[model samples]
Target: MRQITAILVGAGARGRFVYGEYAKKYPKELKIVAVAEPNEERRQLAAKDHGLSSNQLYESWEQVLDGAVMADVAVISTQDRMHCAPTIKALELGYDVLLEKPMSPLSEEVNTMANASRKYNRLLTVCHVLRYTPFWSKIKEIIVSGGIGQIVSIQLSENVGYYHMAHSFVRGNWNKAEETSPMILQKSCHDMDILSWLIDQRCTKVSSYGSLLHFRPENAPVGSTLRCTGGCVVERECPYSAVRIYEEDDPCNEWNRFITNKLTPEGIREAIEHGPFGRCVYRCDNNVVDHQVVNMEFESGSTASFTMSGFSHDISRTVQIMGTLGEIRGYMEKSEIVLFPFGGEAIEVPVTVEEGGHGGGDEGLMREFLKQVRNENSNDDQGLTSAEASLQSHLMAFAAERSRLEGGKSVTIAEMMELQFTQVKGVASPNKVT
Candidate 1:
């Protein structure tokens, strides 16, 4: 067996979880040899949690790659803006890369990263995990089987629950549009990627409109501070109380125990007060849209609508597809597919969940990624969305943001790509992180 040593950049929540799985589940196939993080505390926690020796820790990716060819692969799960540098560096250092999605905060960076992968002839896979889910695979199969013939339109809406959106974009790292683009790019790029893959078409133009209506600093109710549970008069009415929501053992909580326990209660208190989540739900520095609608036209003569809302009652995606002969409606979480023929009643099709993150795509993604890395035969037995396919969809969000800001003008995919190419061609790639 080829022993593949891996390095994890960003010792944050998702990075730690992926590293944990590598350590516990696929120890024989992949070994986490090192970690790079600028955050001293997070670095230490990751080292302690993953049992890394001092020699295996680095303050930055530059330090890790400095005369050290220790990792067979570099997992780039850093901030959106920081993705391109480390990933390109990893490839330059003769390591394959598994990049986390949205590719980068800016379209130019994404093109540069893609260019580096091609230039280096390295296996650079983005973590577009949706292509790995069992439910999505079934959906794709149904569509390919012509469960709805000659597809013409698709309506996909993401219900990014109030708490989830608040936790991630409101109080999290994705609050600012300049820093992250719209919530569309930051959160829905995955959906966009999957949608493009499902339709097998290039998005020609996109026009989007949305705004941060609810979670603004000015929208805080009477007598409410940043945090709802702390001293707000409406604490009883708000459901996002840090105490009530996070006190018990939940999936998100368990996911963070490795790091959360390291923070003292007072530390947590201070963070909540100062962090994005601690802000009033109706009042924050967040500029990303809480509710958005995007109209897209695909090159294949099909149309699509994408809606993302933060105030949804639940976390699920409801999709509708219209075709020449029939129509299909499905829910991602429920895993149900219903087809309505042009002249007949609806028929039910079954869909079920696998068992990990994002409707069980995490594990399925790992399976395919590992198989590919190990040179094992892998197939779309359970649908697998490739890097190029996923990248096309993710880029739509960036294009849509441009459209949204430019008075709802239609932005062409080709135009956006040309702009990115020009910008990246002018920028020199960073020196290998070493």
Candidate 2:
């Protein structure tokens, strides 16, 4: 296989750990030729790891795009709101893009990116990495093969663990809807995408209900301060305590790396004492919902209901797909899938859990993307990662959020899509067609 040269647009957690690491693992198949990251430390580390010289390092995405096109693909893992301009620019600059999800918080921007991809005739694949995992992919395979007959309904629950909720939604980058996006779009778009992909149908209608029910000020303990480092009385006892979760050595082996980049005890303590992760979960200025439920009706008369909550002890997705011939129940945390025929004994499918992030989805997605870039994969119709294909889930999420905010009113995908097109036409230049 020819080495596919790539550009790294954001060197943060996802960019470095998930996508950039792919080049390190399979250097003969892919090569990272350039990078653009604002953070000096992360930029330097990524550049050094990818063997990029000073001339290849850029301080901003704009600089990378403004210069000559340097590589075959651009890996864009910027923040939620920052996905639009860079992706559109990269496509316009003749680079295939691997963009991070939530595409953008706004439907108009999502449409714009999709339009840009089509207009430029460049591949724009979003990082809906869940579709690439063995666990989910096997389910999709079974559904496609008619193993489960026709998918009648799907019930999926994304149980965002307590400490993870505190770390991410309550205290981290996606705390506020105004700042990033609604909890549904920010966190559960993967579930929405999965639901649509499994059903193999476009969503027709959606209704949702949820809110910031538990993490508000009234839910705070009686003597709790705004920050966990402020000598709160219940700091040691509270399970959601920042100091307890971030400062101490994690009992859970999988979570130790997430607590602090500095592996030392002193480094962890210092991060807790100074960083945003140390803030009291209940006292933070978080406005996004802590729980939500969405009901979806598909074009083929199939239905799905997705539940996203931040209070589970385990941080994983559990799905139940009911069909005419058999049923599939999967727990992502356990990496197990159970099949039940209407009349026979249950069959357990052995799932080999991949050894990296997102149950090996991170690697799987990169593998397929490299194949496509190298002209080895041609199944474009089933390409779940493409921007045009991924937009449906974002529209579903937008409609779900609209329904949640509007008292669980049923919102049609047609309405959302029409609104998206109308907005796109309103903002389009004279030479651009709607």
Candidate 3:
């Protein structure tokens, strides 16, 4: 295989995971030639960790792409809204791209990335890493193998788990709808994409209903203001206390503790006190819905309902598929599947668990992407999610958000493409449509 040089943009949480878990495991197929991050501390860390020279660490996407056009690929792990600029730039610069999901904040930007891939003859793949996960893959195989014959509908619910949701949305970048589009687009775009891929049908209509029912000052117990973990008398009783869990656990709390020494107790304290995670989970300025439900109609007459909630005990997903002949229910966290035949008894299927980021999907995706880019070829054997597939998933998310805002009106994929994203309509519009 040819050596594929890759430049990774962004050095945030997810970006670091991609580098450490995925790229670190596949040095032969991929090489980190450069990294672009505005934060000096992070850029230096990436350089030191990857053994790259100072010159290879750029301050922005433009600098990286300008100097590294010869780089075989670009891995975009930037902020949600910033995905379009680097992805479009990389494609135009003759580099294949592995873009992180949700493609971009707006449909038009996603469409632009699609156009650029075609126009530049660049191979662009979206980082819908869940598609590569073993459990999800098994579920897909079961459906494809007719375990649930003539699948009619699917119901998937994500346990967005209160503390996790509080950490991400209530205290993080996705606090408000306007701040980060809707919760659907920001978080569950992957879920929407997974459904589309599993059903093998076009999403024809989408209707949704949701609101910020919790995680507000109104929901806070009396006399308990911001910083529940810091000052609340009930910190020991509250499950969401950062002090009790994170501080007590020290190096054990998987979510709070950092692998590097830089993420010290002082850093955690400072972040929570002033940063997104530090605020009282119940007193933040969050506006995104704590719970949302989406009703979808497919072109092939199949239908599904998707629910996302910020309050749940589990962190994984559960799927129930109802079909003409039988039904399949997948418990993702436990890696167990139940198949209920229409007239016969139910059987349990066991699946293996692999240790790595994103249920072992991250490493697989990196391996496949590097293989394709190194060979400069595309094949079914690789099965990487293409730019088009990613856009379809993102568009479905857009439609779902529209449905939520407009009283659950059905939104067709065609309508979204034609009405919102077919043409250049935004300030950062790509005028030259490919």
Candidate 4:
């Protein structure tokens, strides 16, 4: 095996903690050679971790890719909308890309990215890390091996968890749809991608129903202060209180530091009193839905149902795949799976969870990407979450969002594919579904 050099495009949490940690743990397999981050703190932090020289650090990805193809691959963990430009430029400049998911919120940008990948003949892989997890991999193996026969339907529940919803959707970087993406795309596209992969079929049609039911000004509690750190009458009882959740409990955690990199109690107090994360969850300007349900029809005539909610007690996922011969059910938090055959006994399987984020999927994805880049693995590997595969999932999310705004009207993927993404008053513009 050969060592593959990589450029870090964003030194945010995922880039620094997940991918950068991988390089640190296995320097022989992968090495981080350069970094391009807009923030001085994160950029310098990356440089320190990777031992990068001044010449190897750039303030933006444009500068990193402008001079030369500095590394074998560019790892793009930029903000949601920023994924397209750097990815396309890297491919054009003779570099493969490991891009973060929800490639783009716009259909046109997604299409342009796919075109760039094929035109440049570059290896483009989306970080659909869920597919690489031991839990999901076991499920895929069973379906491929015909352990449960032909796949008839799949049901997935994405429990976003209550505090997570408050931290991310209500007050975090993804607070507003216009700033980032709709909740479905930013948060649940993984679920959409997983469903398409497990069913091994294209989603033909999609319809969804959801809205910002609980996280809006209209839903704010009476007499509540604008910020949780304020002397609100209900501070002690509010579940989304910044005082309790951020400063008191996980003061030094990533989510708290995300609001302000200070990570100290005083800095957190100051941040909550003035910054976004400190605002009352229900009094904020969040427009994304707090809960949603999507129904999809696949090319094979099978159906799949997915639901995402912000009220779960734990941040986890549950799946049940119904097949012609039997059914397979699994809970991700437990890492336990059960197989039940027709008129047969139930069998339980134990999954060995590796020590990494996303149930070891993060590490698994990096491993596979390195193998592919080194020509040790096939680019056409059935498990590769390439740009084309992730494109379908993105389109599925767009169709679902269009359906949500149109009163759950059925929207076909073909219609979404045909129309260019435009924002004339709102997205899914012209309402042209022909």
lDDT of each: 0.74, 0.85, 0.77, 0.86
TM-score of 4: 0.93
Tell me the spans in candidate 4 whose CA falls farther than 4 Å from its real position.
Answer: 250-254, 376-383, 420-434
Clash counts for all predictions: 8, 0, 4, 0
Query: Between 1 and 2, whose TM-score is larger?
Result: 2
Error of 1 at 328 (Å): 2.1
Quote each prediction's TM-score. Answer: 0.89, 0.94, 0.91, 0.93
lDDT of each residue in 360-418, candidate 4, tens digit only: 89999999999888983334552378888988899899899989999999999888866
Q: Which pairs, if any, clash in model 4?
A: none
In the range 361-430, model 2's lDDT, one tens digit per residue, is 8888888887777773333532567887788999999899888888999999998887787777785331
RMSD of 4: 2.9
User: Candidate 3's residue-wise lDDT over 184-273, tens digit each?
Assistant: 987898799889989988888888898888776777776565785466776666666666445566332566643233578887666556
Error of 4 at 387 (Å): 0.4
Q: Candidate 1 or 4, higher TM-score?
A: 4
TM-score of 2: 0.94
Best by TM-score: 2
